[model samples]
Target chain A: MLPPALSDKQTVPFDDRGLAYGDGLFETVLLRAGAPVLWRYHTDRLAKGCRRLNIPLPCQAALDATWQGDCTAELEVLKLILTRGSGGRGYAQPDEVTPRLLSRRTPFQPSIQRWQQGVTVRLCDLRLSRQPRLAGIKHLNRLENVLARQEWSDAAIAEGLLADSEGRVIEATSMNIFWLQAGQVFTPLVDQCGVAGTLRAGLIDQGVVAQRALLLDRLAEVERLWVANSVQGVWPVTTLLAADGSLLQRWAVSDSDPFQRLAHQLLGFA
Target chain B: MLPPALSDKQTVPFDDRGLAYGDGLFETVLLRAGAPVLWRYHTDRLAKGCRRLNIPLPCQAALDATWQGDCTAELEVLKLILTRGSGGRGYAQPDEVTPRLLSRRTPFQPSIQRWQQGVTVRLCDLRLSRQPRLAGIKHLNRLENVLARQEWSDAAIAEGLLADSEGRVIEATSMNIFWLQAGQVFTPLVDQCGVAGTLRAGLIDQGVVAQRALLLDRLAEVERLWVANSVQGVWPVTTLLAADGSLLQRWAVSDSDPFQRLAHQLLGFA
Candidate 1:
């Protein structure tokens, strides 16, 4: 189910800027019933990333063709990467910009138990660096995320939460985090670090979540917490682990819980 | 010329963590008379980078083979990239580490005029972010360098200088910078940001330069300034430009100047 532009026969060039400098952006989209779910949100985010990175956007028609051609799988995870082509010797941009588009599809596997019973998460010791210029866009400069994810290897721990150098909770390794406090839904403001996930954006647009600068101390006051991404939708967090991997707090999610309701709404999106 | 591993026929896998997350490090060595100019320094830096990034060091035999096989060009730019390899879907590292090595060679063109008469450099508006965990290693997460380099397009300007968010002068876009005042050489400490370059390491080891926290105001008191790297050796900076491209300061270099002596010592290495 790979896109024609990124089939098994295709190969990324050795000098691709994406490989050399991580001068690129990517989007992971969920496809259901042979159709890409939240296609507009993904493309819109990609467009924003291109503008921020100053890389020319690939034609919408070309992207649509690839998506349509590859969306045959009933349930699939589509990954698209856009790099600033290749051939600049150093930091300078190439004189001729030919943005490369690579897409691949894999069978989607739902985490039913995690979505049903919720999952445990731990705090990562590695604090994200502040770079307002590259704060929100899903750029390829993701060493911070990699380091954070590597902090824990326990299969039982679903995700690792990251904070900025200032001790403000930013996000999970690969998802946006939202918490309910006194019936108010709040997510971290990603103005200084962290990616603004597509699902989080959609939730914000729907007036289901508000963005705020979250501190580590404030987590004690959260009634319920959940992490969200485009592919997995949302997962209620049952336990929060401290830096030493010790359980710091716990929560129980009932069927009527707002977090559970939000998860259901996201997962049931067509 | 190209190393067999990185010839035009070679291709980087789409899922390589290096491409996907900038989870890699690279080294560019200068070749003179069919030999690597600073082989030990380059390898040492690569080893340090791998240790910092938690990527397994590529086998010594493989690295030797690539370097030894591609030194045919009398004056060549040898590039070596060591990536975390492929198959980590998200931010996680693959269970089995199979680091990939890519090498390339290009004809070296020395900037003799810039070295002899000095070149003009300007300050960049984009301030580098503080990431102590990633500081000093030449990792592939170089979007900061790209954005800083893109600040100006004038061919007359040889390089652009960068500072950290705290307004501390760091380094040039592609090279490490050093300043001289009253016979003392000082370079910005890269512990907070910027690459610890091979040439800079050599200079520091030789006891010719000292690392210090340099501020923008300190530039006014500098008697002489130069930037150095593996490929270009060293280039004396004749004029410094403000962010608005206006002349900020100027320096004259004589043939017997200490900066010129250091440049000759660096360039004459074989």
Candidate 2:
């Protein structure tokens, strides 16, 4: 269901920075029980991204109303997009910036069974370029991710992993990845590239895992793995393959693992 | 005028990857005397960029028709945007991709006096994040450029220069910058960041200038400075300032430079 605030939409101005240059940031969160999870984190990231882009963040009340009321669905995916409003035909943004805040709800959720059974994964040919300045932030300039996700479509393949130019395994196309190596848990350090996922944050903050750069050459050493995003919560990777397209490892994080237990507790999956 | 092609205008599907994630490449060239200046270079770069992003290059027939009826004006700016067409709601792109090419003409010609007197420039506080994969290519993920351009409203300031996270000077908001330092021309290498501008390439190809990484500290010491873009041709800089809100040196290239003369000849400037 489309959010009420966005129901009376007109044509997004041709000069909008978002359309002209992808000059914007967006956050997608799982809406359970008709309430957006981690609303604070999503809003904070949106504001921080706006500040970095020199766009003034919009009002919180207005934003909350846009996402809050008139939603009948209990489970949905809520997407928030904030763009530097229209201006000069060229890239130069207008002096008086009018920001656009939009919210929409879609009745969508990943199959719970898939998360439990673990999903197949592939290694994408496209690499996420290292951009420390833009890394760890969920901005709208996601062509790299788009290309990475496009690499495979077999229903058997659930997600694709991307690496940096230096062959450091960064993250999956849409989720933060964690691998259990030598009984230690680690996820890629997003300081150089990849989004600092909200769910990843909760897991890390809860002392379940550490963040470090994962070199692609060492993929064979990992014993178990899983991916997390705001929407998917936690999905075990049943299989990981080598770049030469050979099986590397398979993983199943039982609900018994302390980390998995923590994830379930934090995500309300418990 | 909107192209008659608009009558049946097939453009980005509502969910175009380009529009959603800025997964695309674009080229804007000057159409004068009924021919596109630097057409081959523009098309070559576009094809290379498409390959980098894994999007199929447009067909020759589509390319020809993109600009055929357009550019009717005696002189105009012809812009062509090619995007990975629709689908893939998330980061994943569709298995089969249809690239959308939109061509339009804009009436634009920089004033002769502005080029002669030189334009004012300011350093942008918004540093461009370095993403080498997208560097040197004219892709649509240009939020940094948009933010830098939004910094000030002083009409006198014609352009803003940006640096990367490490404080290395990159490029101007909308153009490539070149300066003569110690009797050798230098432009920041785009390997770490920034676009490899078409006009900048022309100047280097014609053996009129040299190119290299330029430090922000060295910019003030340059004997002369100029900025170039496909649409703006070239313009000398009379003033320079750092993003720290400090004044740098000012410079204006002599009108007698062979490159300036060539620009005048090619652009039909008096």
Runs of candidate 1 with Cα error greater than 4 angstroms are A1-8, A70-72, A263-270, B1-8, B70-72, B267-270
> Model 2: how large is the Cα RMSD against the reference?
4.3
Per-residue lDDT over A1-270 for candidate 2, one digit per residue giving the tens place of the 0 to 100 score: 122223135224444556568877778887777787777777777767766677777777766765677666767887776667666658766656677666567887567886678887878877776665577878878877876765676778878888887899989988889988778889988887888888887778778889888888787578887877878877788888654567877766576665566776777776
Which structure among the candidates has the greatest DockQ? 1
Evaluate residue A238 in candidate 1 and report its C-alpha lDDT on the 0 to 100 scale.
91
Q: How far off is residue A120 in model 2, in Å?
A: 3.9
Going through the candidates in order, their DockQ values are 0.81, 0.44
